[model samples]
Target: MALRTGPGSPGPGAAARLVVVGTACVLLAACSPPAPPQVPAPAPSTESAGPTTVEPTADPWADVSDFVPGLVTWDSALPEQSVEGDPVEISLGEGEDPVGSFRRTNVGLSFEASDLADERWEPGTSSLTPLIAALNQPSLRFGGNAVDRRVWWTSSDESAPDWAEFTIGPDDLDRIARFAEATDASVTLVLPLGHFDPERAADMAAHAERALGDRLVAVAFGNEPNGFHHQSQLDLALRDEGWDAEAWVGEAEDYGQAVHDRVPELAVDGPGAYDAPWWRAFGEAEIENKVALSQHWYPLWSCPDRSGETEERAEPEVENLTSQWLHERAETVFGQGKDTADNYDLPLWIEETGPTSCPGTNDSSRTHAQTLWTADFVMIGAAVGAQRMNHHSSLAACRGGAPMSMVCGMGAVPNESPRVIAQSNYLALLMLSQVGTGELVEISSSDPEVRAYAVAGEGYTDIVLVDTGEPGTDRAMDLSVDADRLHGISTLTAESLEATNEGRLRLLSEADAVPDSLPRGSVTLLRFSDE
Candidate 1:
């Protein structure tokens, strides 16, 4: 007698379950109503449309490329942007202040001379020789927690000094001396502050003076003292040893003074800090000009939680953060009181920076894309008037530790040699080194993603264009360049993007160069000789 339309249909006592099910159904129906059926509106007749007029909107970016020619400017401190063949002349004679031509900042390797053994020192010599030849690095820093008195000396006995047990013993010193002599690279020594007595500090400077002789350009008292708060430690040590931290800025001034007194020619700078407080303190202290300002920057480490991520995402973020910080810092430090010409006199150097110290950091460090990005960073820093940029881990083989050797593996496994491996950063630096020494000129393109910079050489012009956008999107940039005059152009670019051979950037001919399409994630360096 049960009325049922189907199995489990509501029967005698099923009304209770049915009500719950029915309520759920109603709620679901209310939650997700069916989309209203689309109804096409009636089309307007040709007469009613009135010739189908289109509205015009003003484009603010229109004719932006046209302004490229007039944007050229001149500067005496650095290279000038000039028309390739224009009669606007500047002095760039041979041996005539090479600083103007030395636009490419050389990032030299940092490590202690003591960690190297005699056999290791010989190969290190050969390894660094070619690198120095290739990069023309101006200065090298020796001391990165590796050259501490504890690591270098045989015993802790202060009275009976075994100078033979020190890392800067006769053999290692000889090798460094010979290496510097053979290659025209200058040396920058960092004396250990944590473990050494003042006498050892003085002795270390004396030994460096004798070993390196005139090759030594500068000495940094301690490494990252602001970060370590070693200033307080040095202050305590000085007070305990009956020296005044208030009279001086602790060991930085003391050791620097000692080194300066010993070698009057050698430059000294310090409290190498990651924060602004140390820089402000050092700047306000009326320190000698010979004591240069020093700071270390690792844009990735500044955001440690995300340091090992891929550059595709991380680099842009880091760039933005760094640019913002640098701009604000520059404005705070140098942006006041001038007719836009002579605003601030302080010269800052990015003493250390790199992609990341995390071993898990993306392979972008070894890619050509990284090279382009690094080159862009260099150019941007230079454009903003940074004195120098020393990329961190330039020599460090492993992650999160001092460099094991001048030549070792970059990642966890030691497959590729850091010195010999042709990383994108290495190639980028190489390409930059080849261009003539002149000032940076302005170039414009329709694409916002395409960054263009031009530098006038002695007799030629170098134009560097970078496309920093997502891959697979072809950037159609209408590049309008105004040089002294147009002559001929030589283009250099990478032909491939596949992982295996991506780092290969070649000088392409006019026929092969001007492609209807450029590969995604690539850089083009074009050189134009004056007619």
Candidate 2:
């Protein structure tokens, strides 16, 4: 990996992330460098509780050493790797396009419809609701595989559809509406396509509309119609054999039209396909009131049968958490979807996505690797122009059968878990949450292993650097800048990159620590005033 030593002299190749570093810092008296970033000892679970414990660490970088005026050097442990980086010599000026904002519509969390029923969502009673609010009220999306396999329009005591896991009645939607309101977010529900009854789908939308009112942003049909044929439980309930994209889109539109007939102008989102062709098919189709293009992706699914596996990416056991292949695949997959969405001038949405869709892969998905991955995923989502990059989560345990969400539910029972567990990976959100909402600014990096991005918010531009390589346990790259890198930075803090199994972060400042090369297998975010 090389550095952009000078202009026109770029590093890495086309396959690498297109990122940039802060060229100059606007040093104001208020923008004084806070402190050198350090990894604080892991604190026990203080948020809520449900068997959430901090994975202990060796505290490798605990000792302070002398450093050059501009160079940072040492062993890294991931963030809490010690908080700090070198600010590169660059700036966002005229003619540079600011990418999308991390807003409610753009950044959010997802859940299964039945999962909502598993808890008591009466006002301030639900533990998850408060945490959802902490995410600054990002959009709350309901619908997953459950939409197609587990949902019914009304609460039913009868034989219930063989596929029904739970009934989602008007009352349920009513409670959900209240919950969403309490969380300060909007709602998007994916209706069932398994039943194949346009009227039933329409009826479901009407009930949701009656309950959610203006809070209901849009409605989507089916979870992932392209893969319906693969799941037996959903296969029998869906269209008969020979249900290709052509057939799928036709029926998908039928359901859309049916719902729109009753609730005129109710925005609709669709396909929810996991493949490329399906996205293109939906993009080409002329559906009424189509708002955003949607898809589901699992970048780190450890299923032995999952495609793109090689000796490097073995299953069950965690693969290279910071591999180039992992980052490249994300760039390619999301890039393709973005192209389809762009062709139609629609906003692409990753309706469901995470480290792994399969459960019990805690060895892989639940680690700090996910924290690094989540940071990279956010930058990728911004660069690719995705409108909603909602990380799918479950109230189920993170230690559940497999790894899926950053926010994991604990306890043997469903929502009965004494406390909901927020995994270490969630630190990515907490870090970025600093810049409530902002437009993405591109980062130009000469290093392949290290990719960076800047989010230019109202008064600040946050520079994020992520290391996609294995740990350099012996060496720490002290990135140095010559002049004026903190020009516009008002109040600043820094975190060095280091990977650790421990889930802890202390927002303390050391000295005049401002920003560059971070601890390997870690990520860094530098906040600057855009003055």
Candidate 3:
């Protein structure tokens, strides 16, 4: 007497139980509601959930396709929307020819050499290892302002000049070397040029090579040497005047010559300057010892002190992270380096760069704005013809730490556990690693806010969409790709753009593969694979 209504009235096992219950109810004469009118059992259909009238309306893609849940949507296509017949068209060539490969260490970390000297690294085991190793492949370069200001390089003899305040010994070098191996990263050792000593240079290079072996990629001679003249400290200043590109070239040549004289096989990268004139001069000089030309950069600075000649930048702000000016500034400045590198036939490396210079725990440097900026900035580096880039990092206290550090530790360098913590912006580095090493493809977008970058690999293509618009702003993109080539789609996004220790990653592909409101101030990675 129990009315059963569903896709299937009842299975055999279910019917058996129902029969037993009905018999007991009848015997007791207590069947509820006097048993409703008998109804026929509905047969189950395997072909479809039998036709139930569905109401539909103006949504064109309502019945187009079911959106595969999660980050991946396989065997499907996204509905492309057009803003008045204008949509961002992305063109991926036949996967055979690639302009160039975006190598494994294309995106890396830059650290001040003094950090190593400070014993901040606890090689083999540290909270920093997991995050770095997660990138699969990365490079860590130790060199920065501290190298000239306070740090000194001591080789086997363990010697330092009278002016040297702190010395980086074999122990420190070994610590960073061990860390690089632990994190599966390459090492680039930077030696100070403020006081050039050929013997010291060779000794440091030899020590780095012995400790790092093939893992040692480059022995850089300087860190933003162009700006050394601006250092207010009397001891830090390399030259009072006539410290131009030609002068840097001569000094770099001298350092390069000394290092190679003792360690001929060691690769050298140099002239780490924020300005481009040094790059031109170094390239023009054709410094034979140089394997790559590097430049350190920070679009803006939080520090109040600066040289009178240098133009004053607008105050460092979180909003500036995604500003058009930032991107243009990077392109314009790095474009010069790229041109010189190409002219000289050497690779251009952005050895030091981040959200800002010495942010010292600035809120803007640790926020989601930095995360989004990282996406835009890394792509800009790629587009600007940079062979590789190192985003600067620091664990020193905010006062000593730098701007745009991926993770900032509460305790000073050499702090114990519970003090080292990652910033929310680290999501940016994790996101960049997803693309891995692949050939970059061409993308054409009218709207710059939703920047598009595609990486073509063996049997797959990764498309990274960086939307820098605000939360309430409309950042919908009519992404055009070879739909037929899309076998599966994998994309991940954070729950919210605000600061949160706990990261919540979710898929944002719309049911029809088209959404009016994509997550603002977020990065979306889509992988199209043959499998």
Candidate 4:
């Protein structure tokens, strides 16, 4: 049977395929004939057992309603695991409401430049269009570390090397603009600053501005210049010329100014940094002309370079993928960006981030855990006052290339494949997009395993609870709200944290609702309305 890959399935992208394949291999192994049992002589210690029987244990949740798969159970009358028999109170009215709106651009996506020029992107037939619509975000960024070496396919006569990757031209940009129009999303094209061709970049930028018109948000220069080889190469180039952080600034200024001079309407975003030192320095120099402070972040090395091979990386470790760890990392990185943005009076944009860098992880990045992690990461980013959080994916995976990282390419089905599978992370983003803009009020949970946040929408409140625990860990939160009624309780879950079932967002009414007892390794959202 053909594998139906995508967001909710066992993963259609290369990375998810790897996980699925690995699991299949294990299952295949189990189906094979077992070796002859090497039974040791019976131990002299114990008396012979009657059929080696095992004792039956009481089911703690038997009296409680059985958890129906794909149903939101929201009954506060259920028993609370804590002492005093009360749900853990999440105090919301005490603190000043942190009011903010979630913009269409707030949940953005970053991809390779080549994806913009692919033929498969044709509006009516392409599988990527629906996926893009599901995001419902206002901005889409075309660039990654790939921009460091990307060439503009300027001429048909320019026969490039097999390894060479190229970006779109005016015609390609027009096609992409149509895509943006279809999805109601804008485009942010990152120039090839690593190539350092101001004239060429300016020409491309000008053409893009004309093609995309108001759909263009901003053009960033390069990807992570500081952490990648781009910076090292620039350092070497500076040996002959004046070299310093200002040198980078001067180069960016020249490139950006050239493009700006031609496409005055397009804003320039830059000095994409991955760390505090680089961001602080880059922000200091580029803050004047830049519209936003762009940066990249990964909790730890998702790719092999920072560690070893994909299989060797520990990104999937349940201990590390916990809510506490992810939340802490978000605080640290977002805090730094927030500080820089505050210091320079600029909006901070996390232009690139994922479960890891380089390529995506297998079991870790492709599992249910990532879905929960993504929910918390995005909400935390919004709460931290970030202007936008752009999830990074590659063209290869989207087009059914190879599996790379947790934020694997989103195309789901392989290129030219009949069906487009949505990866798990994409589904997670789709669920997140449903959260309407409002003040992300504070959610306090006494239990560390459970993390909660509330969006105080004018007359409604959206409560999100994530359980980052091993399977069988029971959790519920007593969310005290002033609303007269609560509705739209839903949960995103899978058979196991590692299972790639594509899960789903199941809606439940008050009768079907179970008090915030979110299943282990899942995310639950509750809507409370004054009406």
Candidate 5:
């Protein structure tokens, strides 16, 4: 392994400044220094949660100490290693055209109506807002599959919807509006559509508009309206009304128009379909009120008995969470949404999505593997032209064998067992936010086992790399950075991809270090100076 050094140029204040990494410090000696060195511990490399290093003690060509040691020298050049297996070669083009831009609000979280109606939504003691802020203040979506059946109550005279159990009222919307305000995020509320009522949706829209102001991005009329046509009771109701793709589109338009009449500026988004066919049909329809095309996605169906069980069974195994599976899914899922959106001249937003379509998968969703999968998911979603990808998190607790709850239900006390904390997906969102928003560029990877995505903006370029090889294997990739100096480096890894911790999602963060050998099932993000 070779550790390449720069042409020995002195950095500003090179003698006085010290960077702390772990417990070690490296002296920045450019030439024969004139002043005494104030050696500080090495600074942390970017916001990576992986192994860190300290400066090497011997000559630049001296024996390479442990690279993954608690501390290794990193001053002028990054640590490099020899090729282990077939190295994944990544090449970034020096093109002026950007493939896409990363949206800070691109990643979002979804909640159920009952979550907002909880008593714990007080001003000071609220756990929801803190958790939202922790997750990078992602756009909040109120309503999941439960929204289709949940009823909103404004007055006593109005009868509840047939599926109404927990009545969500104006106060609940107030709580949602308040939560959105605190988190500095836009709110996308899903209206009941299985039992469609334009009046009810319109009133709620008017209230939300007043409370949320511009924070209310859009109003989705239903949750998976296309799939609703298959439900026994829902099918009978829709059949009586002659409900189909075209009809659903018209209904969405009508409901959206009614909401517009109440609040003229609030935009509408929907059919929230599970497949591409419905998206195409919705796009092809004459309805034009939608500001953004919305859809749902799940890489695999892990919970077999969940609602609308599909025959295509792909379990959420650690092995299945690979570069190829993610690559294909990104190409296919985002491709369909982007194509449909382009056809209709609208932005594509994944209103609801997750690692596993069902609630949770024991093997992967609960483990560190979700972090890698989520990084790929977000980056791929951005690369494919989708503006937002809202990861669906049930407001309720994990029931049965499912464990996909981002927060362990509303009213969860802090410091309590299973307290409301950020989940694996939340960590992924935070990492991307720390990486910063920029123009996403094209990054070609030579090896199929290694995937790379780059973002160029804010006078820096960030390259996110992931090694999707199986256990007991490591991937070494040569990355070319067109820059005068390498500034930031970090990696995200664990004991293994399948590892998980109780009370909290067990994860670790090391100081600054450049990764030369990407261990199996790990993700790393590297930042380089443009100059």
Candidate 6:
């Protein structure tokens, strides 16, 4: 617009102004303004925002370690299964009776006297020694078929044969006395009832008293008269014995009464049967303090279809049946009775019991698991208040069959030795013995797979835990204690769930090392020091 200015000033100045304006325009054009490049709003995280979510993986059996302490009882025959020098150290509660292995009944190993003699009996403190030592077992019932065949009592034979000649002779009594002297065990003898000779039965009792003297506990009058009728039928068939049930029962009562009159303090027990008839009969007869009630238990009767054929193949249904049978029998017999501790009262003893009667058969009691189950039975029986239990085991050699042996069957077979070889039952006894003697305390846990029992002793509290769940299932448990009562803990576990042999008893040294997890199908004993 100012084109007509001074020739040099206006023209030059105007030109400079135009150059400046052109430079500013060029700079503005070169500096292209960055246009907003679009970015799709980060696809809403498929996962909800805040904290990164993590899905839990599939985990079954997360809480299977809970358990509760149950009742406990003692099987008097346990010590008889021990090796002599291996004297098991049992812990009894303070102020409790110092009870050791006491023989509650006497039943010879199902072998003849000659067979036992030829087995080369040993004299040291070993398993065999204990068996021989327990020969003086008191309150015995010698009326069974095997007893009639094996024992040569003076009543059966007028020779008044000593125990050396009989299945349990003077030599056996001497050994028992020595064992008692060493291990503090007592004796209970049950006289035989199969033949039912009162005079003969009394003579046998007199013979036992003469040999064992005051050491004798009591005499059991009959084998199992209540079930005698039924059992005799089967037993007679097995032994080819022409037995008359009615005649036998009458003879049994007479013999028992005779023994009762002769030895009132001998503490007799009887009607060792599964049914309530025996208890009712014994009560009705008014045997009073002179007699205690005795019973036999076989959680499983070895029927052809239900025999425990093999370790892995045995049916648990059979075991369940056995348990149910015992439980029902206990209720019927012990529950229906009167409450007084006098004339109308009688204490119950599980005189004879086991997994099977014919432990030597193909379907015999050879499995380790069977022994574990046996332990379960024993614990249950104790919980229910069965006074005492005697597991039927052979104390001598067997007399017949291939692969036939004591460890395999309930009956003693040929070539079987009583050196305390590992058997399912023996292992089970060991586990029970470890619990010692005490009033069973209470323990409870949430996991169904775990079962436990606590026993309080003078300086220790024993806790037994059994895991009955599937193999490899890990169980986590919270173990609480009476902080005021206990101080330290020691644990023992069955190293291998399938191991029924001696190796199953593995004592763990780390007392306070609570396991973060436990293997399936195991039993753990935790001892808490009272100090």
Ranking by TM-score: 2, 5, 4, 3, 6, 1
lDDT tens string, model 5, 1-531? 111112221223212222212212222332221221122233211111121111111221112121111122343333343435533445555222334567656667777754566654543344545556544436677767667766554533466656677677767677666766655567788877767778877887788777777677777887887766565335324335455787787777778677777877677777687767778766765543567788888777645564554543366676666648656766687877888888887888888888776443467766666767777888888777777778877545433323665555323332222224445555566556545456676566666666677776544456676666553444433343212234555555555667652111111122233333434565666654443
Shift in Å, residue 161, candidate 2: 2.7
> Ranking by lDDT, best first?
3, 2, 5, 4, 1, 6
Task: State the lDDT of candidate 6 residue by residue for 265-328, as single tens digits.
Answer: 4456665666555555555553433445666755445344432343322223333322334444
Give the local distance difference test score of model 3.
0.58
lDDT of each: 0.41, 0.58, 0.58, 0.56, 0.57, 0.40
lDDT of 1 by residue, 253-283 (tens): 6665666566656555554556555665555
Q: Name the runs in model 1 displaced over 4 angstroms.
A: 1-125, 145-166, 230-248, 285-291, 302-346, 357-360, 363-365, 394-420, 442-446, 476-501, 507-518
Window of ten residues with lowest summed lDDT in model 6:
60-69
Candidates in order, TM-scores: namely 0.60, 0.75, 0.74, 0.74, 0.75, 0.60
lDDT over C-alpha atoms for residue 46 of model 6: 11
Segments of candidate 3 deviating more than 4 angstroms: 1-100, 118-122, 156-165, 231-236, 301-314, 358-363, 398-400, 476-517
lDDT of 4 by residue, 1-531 (tens): 001112321101212211112111001111111121232222111111111111111121121112111222334433333212223434343233433334445677887776666665566565566556556543578887566665554523456546456645677878887777776676778887666677777887887778777677678766676644333244323133334455566677778778877876567766677767666666666322467777788774544444334443335454566647567777778877877877876677778777765353455656677767777788777777776678876545544353433233344533444234456665566566556456665445555666767665544456676777664443323332212234455567665677653555553334235443344566767654422
Clashes of 2: 54
lDDT of 2 by residue, 373-418 (tens): 7778877876667767778877775454335565655566676654
Model 4: CA > 4 A from native = 1-86, 94-101, 153-163, 228-244, 286-289, 302-316, 358-360, 397-415, 476-484, 507-517
- Model 2: what TM-score? 0.75
Lowest lDDT 10-residue stretch of candidate 4: 22-31
Off by more than 4 A, model 5: 1-83, 94-98, 120-124, 155-162, 231-242, 284-289, 302-313, 359-361, 398-402, 409-418, 476-484, 501-518
Please tell me which model should have the higher lDDT, number 4 or number 5.
5
